[model samples]
Target: MDKVFLVAVGIGILSRIIMLNTDQRQYPAQPNILLSQLVLAFVASSLGALLVPALRDRAYTSITFLSLAAEQFRQVRENRRDSLQNLEDIQLVKRGEAFIEEIARTYEIRNYMCIITSLSTIGLYYLIIEELKIAKNTSLMISSIIGLALTLILKKLLKRESIGDIADVEIVKISFVDECIMKVGDLKGITNIGLKSDRERYLSRGIGIEIIPKDKDYTNAGILFDSGQRQTIVYNLYSRLGLYREHDEPAFVPLPRRNPKKESLIIAFIPMEKDEQKIIEAVKSCPVLASAKGKNLSLENYKIGKKGSV
Candidate 1:
């Protein structure tokens, strides 16, 4: 039981480490935040590792601690949401509420994942050793392999769709209207650049992109219409490429605007590095948030035609 407990805890922690993605766009980038998450993983794993042994010994009271752990995980989610919300004001481009909510929820889900991994590992090991009467060495090896496989499978299942899956992104020429108003592709009146210096900077450094929805039924267009979704895309661009503007330069801020008539999204921004391919790559890499999914309007087969409607 002790060996099984140790193996379960180790595999559980390993599973969490695999899932703990750290990148430029990843939240909880601070060292303290990362350390807190690791500690939580340890606690969750310990509880999970104890679950099987407690059950075998009929210590039903000990299993109640999982509920307490769940409450703590909920508190962690709230804390993450609060932290992100507080930091929004300082960000050049806000992550938007939907994105923040998703991040918080993901953190909670990951902790649950750690618990699940540990529990599964111990359960499998117990089954192999006690029920099947398998050799101890072989049982350990099989349980370890299966646990790792389960972790990878869960990770793949949790993968979210990216923006490129829903839309076609292309670099468009940045033009000017009245020599001051910015025009990205056919998108006009993006914003007025009254200062000649700002205008010149835009003319030289500006990058434009038109995101055309791939769905013929306009489902992707509906997703693009969401203000939070649009903000997320702009944030991705700014975060990945690095914004060019100073703290006071509101003019350089990127605003992703929708063309309702065309059912497309467009944006014009100046980055620290003027690489067109990189900008396109950034936007394409933006995740299609689960909360932003548009309801399928193409359910014509399910819809009963009105008496006078076509």
Candidate 2:
């Protein structure tokens, strides 16, 4: 039982580490943040590993510890949210409330993943050893395999739908309307710039993109029109290609607007690298946030209801 517990805890920690991916987003990049996550992983794993043995011993009181773990995970979500919110003032492109909440919820859910992996591993070991009467060493090997396989499956399940999944992104030209108002592609009335210098910089260096939703019923259009989703897309692009503007330069800030009639989204911004392909790719790669997922209004029932109402 002791050996089984150790193996379960080790597998749980490994699962957490596997899921703690640091990409271009660079979240959990700081050493302290990384260390804190690992420590919580350890705690979550240990708690999970103890559950099988405690129940076998009829220690029902041990279940209370799981409740404590839930409380701790909730606190982790709050802490993550507070930390990100505090950094908002300093960020050139702020992550909106929807993005922040999504990130916090993700961190909380990951700790629970640790618990689940650990529990599954230890529970399997007991089943093989006590019921099937398998050899201890063989049971350990089989349980470890199962735990790691489950982790990989969960990782695949966690893969999010990117903007590319729902829309087609095209590189467009940044043009001016009436000299001062900037237009992305042919979609006009995006923003107004008073300074000629700003206008010149924009025309010379800015990248414009048009995102056209593929869904004929306009489900993807609804997603693109969300204010929070648009902000998240801008933030993803800014983070990847880097923004050309500074804190004081409001004229250069990236702006995204929707063409409601066409069911498309447009944005123009000056990138630090000035790579049009990179900008397009970044926009396509932006994850469609959970909070901003479009409703299935295209359902036959909904369409019938709309027609009836009209």
Candidate 3:
């Protein structure tokens, strides 16, 4: 599209130059007829240029959709293989799991339209130049070349921008309740966690544990009457805890105040059977889940009614 627009501008400049240099008196006196032909040629060329890009953009979108479909099929095949092999794979699989809504914000569809429109205008300019038979002026040819160059650059830039958007989509955040009870099922991250207003809603509804960083730390301290006593007490507590015992610490701990600001991505799965090892392995394998070095609450912890399932 951009290329077409540039072509139009180039042609327009060349046409203007030709008009300035050539004597209208030397040609047939039907000035109005010649003028109309030039105008029609310019319009048609510009429109054609724009239409090509628009169609191409649509084609790209279609390809993206097909690619997504193919990925889904691959996932289905993997699931079947795991099932027949009695492999411990997670049961639940979420369709379109890789797609994130943020991608739409980064990949501006309007850019495609702009490119198409510009190219169309360029095409019009080219047509006008050819129709006028003003071969002496080189401005039209030069401009057309410039337009083509600009279009190629614009395409590269747009593609780079699109790649960034794809990266953002792959890193979307997901939140979910972390449960202590083990169960076999697919779990996905929540888009939002209403910690203040809906904290109770999450708690009363069922398992309230949310996935959290594995490196999270909490400690209890007691004040002693003397500094020496306090120091001794702290030392004793630290020395008494064994390394193995520390490694076996529970995934969740009580907090003085709820802070739901955690970094994680959403994961969705389909559960086919009840197998704890398989479920845990699946969760661990999920891109969102695997990316975070944290313990997650299983879906079993949430006590939402059957009717409230997402």
The most accurate candidate by lDDT is: 2
Order of all candidates by TM-score, from best down to worst? 2, 1, 3
Across residues 203-301, which tens digit of lDDT does each residue of candidate 3 receive?
332222222223222110011112222222222222222111122222211111122233211222212232334333332222221112123234323
Would you give me the overall lDDT of model 1? 0.83
Residue by residue across 1-310, what tens digits does model 1's lDDT show?
7787888899888888888872224442778877887899999999988998899899999878999999999999999999999999999889999988888898899898889989998889889999899998799889988988988998888777778888888888887889798898888998888899998888899888999877433567777777888988998888878888888998888888876656689898888899988988888888877788855466322312223323
How large an RMSD does model 2 have? 3.0
Candidates by lDDT, descending order: 2, 1, 3
User: How far is 259's C-alpha from truth in model 3 (Å)?
Assistant: 11
Misplaced by over 4 Å in model 1 are 22-28, 215-217, 296-310
TM-score (C-alpha, index-matched) for candidate 3: 0.22
Model 2 agreement with the true structure over 201-240: per-residue lDDT tens digits: 9988888889988743356777888888999999988888
RMSD per prediction, one decimal?
Answer: 3.5, 3.0, 24.8
Cα-based TM-score, every candidate:
0.91, 0.92, 0.22
lDDT of each candidate versus the true structure: 0.83, 0.84, 0.31
